[model samples]
Target chain A: MKLLSTCSLRKVRGRNLLIVPDPCSGNPDRILEVTDSFAWLVGHFKEDVFTVKTLAIALSERYGLDDDTAAKEAANVIQIWQDYHLIEP
Target chain B: MAGLSPDRALTLLFPLLRLSLWGTPLPDAVKQETRLLNESDWEVLISVAKNQSVTGLLFQAVDSLPEDIEIPDKTLVQLAVMADRIEASYRRISTASEIVLTELRNEGLNPVVMKGLSCASWYPRPELRQSGDIDIYLPKLPTKSGRHFQTSPDGSLHFQQDGVDIDIHSRYFDIHHHTEYLPSVPSPEAEWMMISLHILKHATTSGVGLRQICDAALLWKILPDNSKASLPIIFKATHTMRWHLLLFSFLEDYFHIQNPLRHISSKPLLSIIAHGGNFGHHSTSRSRLLKAPSFIRKADTAFRFLLRIPFSLRFAPREILPTIKELTTGNLQHAFTADSHSILH
Candidate 1:
């Protein structure tokens, strides 16, 4: 799934951060801070929804992780994004 | 301009605020504005914008650049990204306010939202304003609710659930608390007085930023024409007439706000506001003041810190007294406990 239009990846102090605006943050706040890996995924999947396999491949290529581990991490990251409505399937 | 040292950082941040708050439409000046900012400068500017609670608005100001404004390509990319983050933040604030206000009302708390959310309506696009924690009247509600409230070291009561934060205030000033604070009173005088005092209190002690000063300006701007005549009387009663006048002048002088609420700007007060951009955080660092190569400069820094004690004592004795007591006697708990009566302003 693609990142929601309401959310954007920002570079703050040289760190990649995902800034999710209100309601989308699942609570009241103008913005919510998220991790760099999550930011990487959002950046990678900016337009189209990517399959779990595609995400795992990207993760494996980026971090040199084994296929199974990358797939698991990709699932976990995507699940978190879905939970926050940062992405939609 | 006593405290102002041609700070490169504030120069960028303050004008950006002017654009955001006043809708003044600066199409030309912005071209040369962000030209010299290095990474360190951007860091400080971003940090100050967040501290002043205006990051989202700053993004809006920069993002509205015309094709002719000529912002650096990298800066434009950064701003486009920041605009996305800020938009998300605006949504989060709106959602959070709705959830918290609904919860509070359902509990018969009679919650009255304060500051950020309340002042936002006066802006051109309400969501463009960056919101901090949702501030509401004291958490002690009407129906004997069980929501626990915590007091942080900075003397604000906060209610946190999941990842959302709401700061509960018992009084408009440092010394007062009322369970029936705002829910019972719908007076415009009370609202204006509170805004005035907030700006005054922050300016005298910690040094306010453009965001705070703009709140005061917007409050004045939104007041009905009939109500405008009463500002002097209200200010006089709160004993903040002079301070309010000085702030209004600064709003007019630097930020380009027109039709000010008052006309009182002396050199001394202007110097204070100019020097203390964003809580007395000028362009230079404080340690540099102490490390001055000249004896006079070193003494000035020491004297300046000492001089600030009385104002600090007057406005925020709750924080300052405890800090001084701790510094001298090495005691901790006594200076910082949460109590309304402990600090008498």
Candidate 2:
């Protein structure tokens, strides 16, 4: 399957959140967000997951964060989104 | 030249060089040209030489280029190694695409090989472009399981080929809006029509910056459009028309986007949609409704969740009127902008 895009969480309401597709995502319209931290991205989005280390490296370049910080933040947000039923896992 | 940074020049030229070496059988002159490199180019050449694969060498050379060019020799050696590896990888991919096409044909499936493979084959000079993997578009119905035919229990489809991967799709997107509008048209029997739809759909949804899409569109325009023309015969060859309709419908709702038919000639897309072809459904994480099997599953959910918000917001931009206007009317030249370097294989 073609990968449409990727996104990240941004807080919206007090506890509610909004998910935003990364502008850099190749296909920006493939998935929809349920909340800031979660979305209904794709059926096989799980298959494309990168490790925290890998994600950190990728995010660091775009977000201006260091690798360790990027990894930790990504891991925390991912875990929270998963628990919230926003993502597939 | 005045505006281009050394890093940017390296970034663009490196891929050109790698693709040229890989897809084209370079003469000794070109090989020598590669060997005699400038300080920046030398870094890339050395990186390719050290790395075993040309693709890997290209990536390494790109990665090792100094943000500021203080250390030249070390970088040049690194680049040479990478260049060598990239050259090898390109050859492997070209060979692999032919093999995969043959295998698919042997299985009685007519695969309209997409992306890099098609580009390499159809382009005037294949060596000028680099491709990561072979993307083959096959017209098939998803099983009742609602997944690609080859997806394993782990959700990864492992093809036997090395340094090459496959992404098979029953539909172009998870959300496609126009399935219901064209339920009466018959399924396409000809290879050219099917391939044309594939290329058209890709171009409409992704916009134009992608070289692969342009290649597909160009090739499709040149290919003959006539073949068999019978519903029963087409159905027998492929799956039922209902499956296609459902797949298209599902894509419409899932992505929350309109049909790509708007961008292309309406006749063919209308025909495809008129047939019982539907889009795929919005991909909700099964893990969300059940226990996920792995960390990848969880990560997938998280990523999707993040994506859904913007997708929804974009679908209903009026709700966020100011941001919508700013984005839509802003100076941004492209509808979608991505860090292409990050996705390089």
Candidate 3:
């Protein structure tokens, strides 16, 4: 999954947020709070797409965690981001 | 008065900002004071930075302090977050500016971008500078009449475009009605003169802010030696040589730039900036004057004008009467006049 072209990650008022511009003029821009780890994960995929397996591998390398543990964590974070419509498959 | 005898925040913030904007070596006294800042002091410093529209610059300074310097992790995080948000906003404004500029060019108008984006280009990371409305100078457009004829007397036409405000100016400088001293449009000489006069205009009226002064300082630092030598003569032609010296000297002291200009009385101007924050939004009487009854508002405005008289007289005496005339006549004529005929959206 990759971040939507129109969406971006920004830290708003001290909170990490996934900013998605609203399509409707009457609606406000969507701001979804993201965890620090999730923001770090997003940084790695800024120029490319990533799947749970790739994220897990990257996370394992960065944090020196076992592959199984990293994969579960990556899948959980990615699921939340997908639900928020920040990620496009 | 408040800025003259600055409180704790200004004391620490001044040196930190100098370190941030230029790589000026921090004084021992300043470093010690910074180390002693409590959490509350940090909050005040952050507030001042935000109010002055220099959060990203302050963040860089704070982040680059020596290893032994003990800024709380939470403070660092706050500054970082705010800086990120400012940069994000700058990106939006930059894209919007490009769209507006392209559309103006498509319409056969030669729009020379002034202030906002132009100043940002001098910074190491242009995206980190605080962005505002785009000010474009259209030399071809006549001040008296144009496609956008609803412009203010000062030759500015404002409209919303590409989700950002665009101010089209038919004239380069707002200091004087006459352009006898100014050279041809689109030249570097005229641009620098315009920037200096813009700062003087604000300083003599509502009040100048640190951001504009920082812009002038950064722009001055990059100018060639010959260009620097030529500026005094241009300012002299416009009868603003005194103001030019005062401003550059102040910048030299504040930003600690190399080759200091001859010292002058910059305290008054510094006080104005410290009190005004960004565009006088943080002036002591601003909120009170805004929410007061009509009579009280008038009184407050008069009082503020009186306070500004001495500074105006010292810096740019030619502007005092014009400012007074503006105050009395009121400038309610030019608000978002090009809405129906916006150049772009």
Candidate 4:
């Protein structure tokens, strides 16, 4: 799935910080600083919906990582975003 | 966005709000008078405005721009998606102010609504004005709220409940000494005068921002005929007419909002306005000066502090106490908190 429109990544203090739109206030609900690893994952697969298979393919081409490892990392990041309501189906 | 950081681009917003709210087409002044910015500036601008508590006004300003202006699609989407939320927050806070005031009145805690809530209605779009806190003056604390409060050095008690900061004041704006200023029945004249005094008081010492100047300007512009008749006398009585007139000049020059007190010159007070909002948060030159090494800026600040003695003595003698206290106390934010970083952290 893709990041929701509300999910805007801001670069603050040289760090990629996630700005999740607060549904109630229509402003930034939470500003969650991203891990360098997750930030890298986001850079490759942004805006458009992407599945584990898609993420694995991009990672294999770019980083030469095995499909299984890439898919595993992708799943972990996706789960974290889902918990935060930052991504869309 | 090209040469400037987002912090610099945020300066573009207040000017944008002024132009957009005019209901006029994007004027030629956009390129020359205000910062010439494009879509690349939007993300940082949005971030900065939010930090400054001006997201509502920023959105309304950009939304009102003419369709022909070439704002990037992504920037537009980012700004537009939050429109409903901004309105919701504004309404929520506005409602909260009404609720708190009504509840306080019921408890016989009759307090005058200070700068934020009272001056909001005077704006072209009241909800767009950033509502920071609901400040009210109560001679005594109300036990009904039951929430614990942190008292600032100025002797004001702040209670945070339901996302609104409710500040209860004892004696300020020198209102206790002049009960006749705001009668039991508050009027626009009284409220605006209080706001002007508040702005002038801060403007003289620490310096104020465009948002505050906007409050005083609009309040003056919108006063009813009867209120206008009585306001000058009140301003004079409060020793704020000179500073108010100076503020009038600043507004007239920057926002094109004319004050009837036009004949009054603000030459003496111009340097204070030069300090810019919240003492030059939006000032390009000040920002550049700040980017200097810490030692240089500290020395510069020290020099400015020394200069303020003579300056305040001439322009605003009321600053003597606060300045002396701040110097002695080392610019502490909380009266009770000893940890210097507590407020920041």
Candidate 5:
């Protein structure tokens, strides 16, 4: 899956905000304050098409975490992002 | 804040606006002024900022204030809320712009983004520049998706995609004349003329606020020397030299930007803005007149528009006759009918 082309990540006043366009008719964009880990994952999605398994492996290698721990964290984050319409298949 | 004299309030308000300018370092003088302002003064500034449609920029300035500045907690919350809403609007407008532009491009049209989004890139925080709608300039009406758009009385197209407002203009200016010099393809010169004309158009009619002034100032600051050099000729050709010179002085007066061209003192514009607020919506005189009995209100509004004619003439002498003609005819459409290649003697 990849990050939605319409969405953008911005650093405003030291906050990492993921700007998600609302799928509904209302106008205001949904700005979610995202953690550094979530932002990092979003960055990867923006640059490369990746599945949860691939992303978790990359996360595990980068942070030197166990495979199971990285996999669970990545899966949870991806699931939440998907539900928010921030990521697309 | 609401009841403060507009002139007295502007004394404090101008410094805050200068402080809010993107990429300009917070001046020591501004810091001291901000530091010294009591709660009441800050409240007045907030009220003025809201009226002027510049609360987002004000929030940025306040946010950048040094820790010891002692902003009231209530003021802080208010600005924060305003900033958040500004950000949300910015994102929504940006997305709508992209979608519309893509759609236009897909249909083989070269659409130029105008005003709001065009000016945003020059800001430190693009989103902090509040945008109400996305404006796109098309050479002609779109043929395919044309049905999706609604035609405005002034001949622009309006569309709402995903709940975001978008306005498409067939021509850059609503006013007639001076457009022949503008290139078909966008250039710095074209953008400058477009911005200058937009400011003049609004300033002549409803009175422009600080936001439009800031847009012109910011664009002028970064405009290349070659582009800047072309302005005198463009101004002369467009018969807008007086308006352009006055704008330069106005920027220097308020924004503290030096005029690359010769300076002329700003006259009447500031007072008009102070009294009228953004697009004259917050005009004290207007509000009072509005509250009068229905018949009286109509008379006062007409009288008010008439009173502004002299001020508009002083700034844009070329526009006076056309404007008067339109007013006399009582047909607003006549004001927009293009005068084909007519040059003022």
Candidate 6:
């Protein structure tokens, strides 16, 4: 079985950090407390296609937020994180 | 299939129950009964059948009849009594094995028995050590020599009496590359060294816990100083402590067994550190190491290293990593199936 990259995007002290280096760089970025939901989304999906439905479920569980609000907020935050290059498509 | 006789079934069931309680899964009834058994009762049965051949009446007392399919109350009581006897036997065998190992050394045969026997002789208490088979290490040619060795036609070691199983190994790590690190040393010296390395590697890398390393250190302390000369052979056989250390580091970073390094008594940990190759400081806690993210990296590195070993000397890396993962993750059904396909051929 192939070993998959586990690096993910995180927020350390309010600054968005990429915990893992891009594969091309061979050095990982250091971020703090980037919840598994964020990591899973970033690791498995392209940022451009990261949907509100997926973000909602992930955020609801990740931050203990109620469903509809979490969905709305996660979609917005994911777009912002993407715009900031905290995650790559 | 040959169905077990009632008496034989009881004999099998008692230990199976204990093993299940130890960690293996078992039927609800058996689990319930096992929970009712006190630690002392558990100790008793383990002690009796550990290393002796008991026949006739004592056997009958512990044995149940095939006609009675279920485990009878009388049989259970007998089992409790037998547990004490078995535990005593475990101790006696451990002591005797220590003596026998010394004799084997005198005969110029390097011998190291693994698992429970090692635990009984090396661990704090016989009961704490549980093993179903005897794993012995036999030193052959080094991996660098480009030679492969197998057990003799008669087998490396095999003898059976009553119903107990006895197995002997001339090698460890069914894959050839891993076995290559084993080098022939002068008898008991080799045994002691192998056991120490096994404990160290398992504790540090596999995250199996600190108890094993503690046991190894205890054994090292108790063994006569005359065996000290053999310590170098372990390094030579395994090609320095780097491989084991790296292996442990990788495992710790990935699998997250435990950091006995932190929990273990200072004295033994100090002893290991003083020896100085591969044993070093690790900053991460056990929990971080167990998560999938860390494990993937660690496993990847370990897998890469195994791949770099000379192919001729190596077993299929493709097979080893998955098997190790399955085994470590407690997927025994899959692990056994994978093991049969990879090793049996």
The TM-score, computed over Cα atoms with residue i paired to residue i, of candidate 2 is 0.33
* Model 3 vs. true fold: TM: 0.78
Score candidate 1 by DockQ: 0.08
lDDT of all predictions: 0.59, 0.38, 0.70, 0.61, 0.72, 0.41
Q: Candidate 3 — which pairs collide?
A: none
Question: Where does the lowest 10-residue lDDT sum fall in candidate 6 chain B?
Answer: B277-286
Ranking of predictions according to DockQ: 3, 5, 1, 4, 2, 6
Off by over 4 Å in 4: A1-89, B1-15, B24-26, B29-36, B41-55, B81-86, B143-145, B172-185, B263-276, B279-311, B322-345
The order by descending TM-score is 3, 5, 4, 1, 2, 6
Candidate 3, residues B200-301, lDDT tens digits: the string is: 876765566677777888888888778777777777787887888788778777776653357777777778777856554433332243344545544555
lDDT of 6 by residue, B256-288 (tens): 323222222233332232232222111132223
Selected candidate, larger lDDT, 3 vs 6? 3
Question: Quick one: best lDDT, which candidate?
Answer: 5
- Misplaced by over 4 Å in model 2 are A1-89, B1-80, B122-124, B141-158, B172-175, B180-293, B297-301, B304-308, B315-345
Model 4, B1-345: lDDT tens digits are 264464355446547756644554445666442335555566777665554445666666766665545556566556544544555556776788788788778877777777777777776777667665577877676666545665544556665557666677775453322445453336677577667667655544455555676676677667788887777777676555666677777667555675667645555554554344455432332224424654554455556556566655665565567555654454244433631121211
Please tell me which predicted candidate would have the highest TM-score against the true structure.
3
- Please write out the lDDT profile of model 1 over residues B1-345, one tens digit for every residue: 122124555566666777677666663555455644554455566655665556666776766544445445444455545555455556777788888778877766766677767887877777666554577875453334456654433345566544456776655543222213322244565677666666655554455666666777778777776666776765555445455566667767666656446565544444545565554333233334323444454344345546567654543444455444433342133235432222112
Candidate 6 stretches greater than 4 Å from native: A1-89, B1-115, B122-129, B136-161, B172-188, B200-211, B224-237, B243-345
Tens digits of per-residue lDDT for model 2 on B1-345? 134333333334433333333232334554444444456555443332222112332433334333432334444333333333334456777787787677667667766654456555554435433455666666662222212223423122324355465555444322233333322222323332344344333222221122322243334334434422242344323332333333233233322223322232233332332221221111222223223443454444344334334433433222234333433343132223321112112
- Candidate 2, residue B84: lDDT: 34
Question: In model 6, what is the error at residue B45, expressed in angstroms?
Answer: 22
Error of 4 at B171 (Å): 2.9
